[model samples]
Target: MQQPAVPELAHTQTRPIHWVLTATAVAAVVALSTVARPGSATAAQSATGTRTTTAAVAPGTTGVQFPLDCGPVKALVVKKAGADLDGDGRPETVAVVHCDAPMGTPPDGVYVLTRSADGRRPRVVATLVRPEDRLTVTDFAVRARTVSATLLGYSSDAVPSCCPDLRTPAAWQWNGSAFIRSTGSAHSV
Candidate 1:
């Protein structure tokens, strides 16, 4: 047996619903902009604009007041030694200081901060304290992997004894990695 022929439906054109929704959204945005604040939008628009200004202070100096609890940092100095102390290619940094409390009382003892690289944050590698003798460091020098720190001893003016006016100077040397007391007669100035 053979099959019969089937009929087709009529074709019709239709506009997309998405296009109408998009036009409605654009119209709403325009209406909102017309009723918005006058300068608010303009200020936001100019936020990325370029402007010229000058800095009041130079680098490495504090411009604003800072807290006192940042710790006592009296003196700091760094120099490049000819030979490397840590076996690295870079020279060592010699930072000497007179700390406030942790090292000693009133006039604190001396500290040396050693570092392998220059312009880097120093770490406290060695500290010299003479609390019993009441000594405080005043100056220091580091050369040939040895550090000689100068200390000043204080004495009361009320005592009128034959003590030779105690102004003794002590020295400490760096034995490759650590500072050790040098054996010699304690020099008095």
Candidate 2:
């Protein structure tokens, strides 16, 4: 059977991100698997018995990568937007950080980082989009000083990857201090 529809985001501004976002999420999983982990567990099983083997990080060798340390970040994002969010015309960044252990669950966060003179490092000026409020991020968009994320219903062990059930389009704008989702516009698809 064919999959169900993924409703486009509320505003037309966010629609372009749909295909890009969906493909990225799927690609993230496939891409990360190829990166050979120096030391990880392996399972060996035969008709007789099953044995498991694991290796620890070799003293100084960093295991995965920075973000991969948590989980393989699919469509890894540590920055967003190429425009100056502060009107300083210096440009800003948006990233998904502080994820849960398994990652992609509620309680995750989206951070807005602004350019700093100390270096090219971007400082976290705002934290927005918690997992508890919405489902998994299906897509995202940034425009007119607003950040929009498209969330689709997902369960830990439920739901086939071929079909996601619902879509809630949320938009959050900087309110002088933080990024918060605007009221009402969520719907199922």
RMSD of 1: 26.6
User: What do the candidate models score in CA lDDT, each in turn?
Assistant: 0.44, 0.53
**Model 1, TM vs. native:** 0.38
Per-residue lDDT of model 2, residues 1-189, tens digit only: 876598665666757688899899989988888785555433345567754343211111112122223344332353345334545434456665434444334333565665445533445566665444434564666778777777666444476544556676777765665556774555556
Number of clashes found in candidate 1 = 0
- lDDT score for residue 88 of model 1: 32
Worst ten in a row by lDDT for model 1: 55-64
Judged by lDDT against the true structure, how good is candidate 2?
A: 0.53
Candidate 1's error at 90, in angstroms? Answer: 3.6
What clash pairs does model 1 have? none
Off by over 4 Å in 1: 1-88, 99-108, 116-120, 130-133, 154-165, 187-189
